[model samples]
Structure formats: structure tokens, C-alpha cells
Target: MTAKPPISALTDHLGYWLRLVSNHVSASFARRLEAEGVAVAEWVVLRVLYDVDALAPSKLAARMGMTRGAISKLADKLVAKGLVDRADDLEDGRAHTLELTKAGRALVPRLAKLADANDRAFFAGLTAKEREGLKRLMERTAAQLGLDDIPVS
Candidate 1:
């Protein structure tokens, strides 16, 4: 008779622990954003646009590691929400650019504050040094995995 391998418990994996914390942190942030009438994905786009006056949708897609179609859908929602503006590219009539509206510019800081608070709430147990170390480890792991995508969900 062949011997059978032992099964491992879910808690035996690092990803399980990471996911447990990530899910709670992400959900809390999402709920905080809901009061401001923005989804996690929308908040990500708004935050990105906040750093620049405008960007081409294609460029934005490349930076975000998302498909142009996905970006277009998100942009459409932002436009409808009056948080973003899509304008004809001044130099290229055939192309368009995406920029945050005045409302969006004003809202970015508020949303950022919420993000900060959510992070603190979840990570408060870690000391400053421990938090820094944890961050370094996560970044290193992501680099090892060749992950450059800005996580929105």
C-alpha cells in the first residue's frame, strides 16, 4: 500500500494570513469611501489623476496595469459623477485626455485621509519599526513576483 501525504491546515500558509488582514483592511476602506460616494476602483483613478494635471487614457492604462477598456469604463463613471473631465487633446484632435475636475481635486485629500486612517486602524498593533519591516517584506515579495500593478481591489 502507498503512504498518503499529510494535509496542511489553511493557517499553515502565509497567504492565508495576508489575505485575512488584507480583506479586512480593504473592506473597511471601501466602506469609508462609500460615504463619499466613490468605489475603491474609482478612488484609485482619482488618486492617480490627482498627481498630474491630465493624462492620455492609454498612458493611464499602462501606468495602472489595466486594460484600456477597463479604464474607459471607469473614466465614463467618473465623468458621469462629475469627478473627471474628458477633453480633446489640444495637440492631437483624434486623441483625448483625462483630467480631474475641480471637485475631484478637492476630494482627493479627503479620500487620502480616509485611506490613511484605514491603514492605521488595521496596522496599529505593529510598532513603527515593525510596520516598516513588514512593508519592506511585502514590497520585496511583490518585486519577486514581478508585480507592478497598482492594487485597487
Candidate 2:
């Protein structure tokens, strides 16, 4: 048999390294959020609603770069969880808006703390400056890729 040509190892790929770190960070944060009875996507919705107070479902769908059906599904789950309120417009019966319930508003800061802790734990090996540099690089890469949607998953 002829000798095989040399090939790069998995560790030779930048994507492999990035995926390693990303998966660990994401899974850890997800577990923390799960313990608090929230999914990562649901936490994203709650955080967004915390900023805007209320918004039309269509508007929220557009803002999140998600389909209306996806937003509706998430909203249904949140409504059932008592973390969000869905109300039809007083003037337009067909139109509805969504907002965080009082409990959701109260939970946001706690969730935020959990998020910060998770980030710190995963990045503990990096210095502050290094972390900032990494963040800037990642942000620039994402911007170059036209990736503006928040990472919900």
C-alpha cells in the first residue's frame, strides 16, 4: 500500500478549540439556569422583556430573529410558568402583547447573577485583559459573519 498523506489533527483546527470552550461554557450556564427552572431560551426572553416592559408578539419575534411560531411557543411556556403575561389589545382583538410578570421581573436579577457567575467560572483561567481581548475578537468575528441575533441556545 502507498503511504498516506499527512492530515491535520482535530486540535489543529481553531473551530475545534472554540467549540470545546463554547460547549463547556454553554452547558454549564444551561445547567445553572435549569436549576432555577429556566431554559436558556426562556431566560433570553425574560431578559429582553425586562428591558422593554411589553411588546407585540410580532415585534418581539422580529427583535429576537425568531419566527412568530417559535416566539408563541416560548410565550405559551412562559405563560404557563407564571413568568409572563399575554394580553390582547383593548382596541384590536386580534393583536396581543407580552410582558414579564412580577415574578419574572424579580427573577431576572437573580438569573443575571447566575449568568455572571457561570461566565466567571468558565473563564477563570484568563486574566481580565485576556478575557476582554477574547470577547472583542469573538464579537468582531460574529459581526463579520453578520450574526446579530442574541445567542438563546
Candidate 3:
């Protein structure tokens, strides 16, 4: 019988390296968000809602590449926290539009600052050029993969 080839080490794959970095970055950001009394998913939703007057739940779900049910759940949490408001769509009574409350609007910038700080904290080892190159490479990879989803988790 022929002997099987040995399995590769965990670090042998590019995905493994990427995941290691991603896990650390995401966990750090999650902690930062928690300190602000928000979840990563909630932050994604709020960031999207920050610039808009109001947007339909269905549209938001599509834009975020999430299911309507998932969007609804997130929205429910935000609404409960008094950070978002849900009102009946003017043109479609059956549908609802979501908008940030005044408090939510106020919190978005602060959260954005935290996001910036978290990124700097993790990536500060890289030079500015290296950081830009890494970001460009990641964006190119995502575009190549046709990945448009707003990563919530």
C-alpha cells in the first residue's frame, strides 16, 4: 500500500494567516463596541444608517447582504435601545422605514472614532504605506471574489 502524504501545518495556508489576523482584529473591535454598549452587528447597522434619512428594511437587508429576518432582529435590538426608530413607509403601509434617533446620530461619530482607534492599535506595527497596500490588496481580493457584503460579525 502507498503511504499517504503528511498533512500541512496550520500556518501553511494563506487563509489560516488571514483568519488569524481577522480574528484578532474582529475581537478587538467587538470589545471596543461592547464598551460602547453595542454589538458588532449593531455597529454595522448604525454605520449604514448614519448618513441616511430613512431606509426600508428590505433595502437595508439587500445592501448589507443579510436576510430580512436578520435585519429585523438587529433593528429590533436597536429600537429597544432607543437608537433607531421604525415608522410605517409613507408609500407602503405594510413596509417600515428605519432611521437613527437623535441619540443614535450622536453616538455614531464616537463609535467611528473607536473603530479608527481599534484599527490603529492592531495595525500600528505596519508603516503607513504598508497599511495602505494591505487595505488595497484586501479590497482588490474582495472585488475579485464579488464580495459586497457588509461584514457584521
lDDT of 1 at 28: 96
**Which wins on TM-score, candidate 2 or candidate 3?**
3
* Candidates in order: C-alpha RMSD to true structure: 1.9, 1.7, 1.6
lDDT string, candidate 2, 1-153, tens digits: 999999999999999999998999899999999999999989999999999998888987787788999999999999999999998888888999899999999999999999999999988899999999999999999999999887776
- lDDT for each residue of candidate 3 in 113-153, tens digit (9 for 90 to 100): 99999999999999999999999999999999999988877
> Cα deviation in Å at residue 35, candidate 2?
1.0
Give the Cα error of residue 103 in candidate 1, in Å: 0.7
TM-score between model 1 and native: 0.92
TM-score of each: 0.92, 0.91, 0.94
lDDT head-to-head 2 vs 3, winner: 3
Ranking of models by TM-score: 3, 1, 2
lDDT of 1 at 72: 97
Tens-digit lDDT track of model 1 for 1-153? 999999999999999999999999999999999999999989999998999889998988887888999999999999999999999998998899999999999999999999999999999999999999999999999999999988878
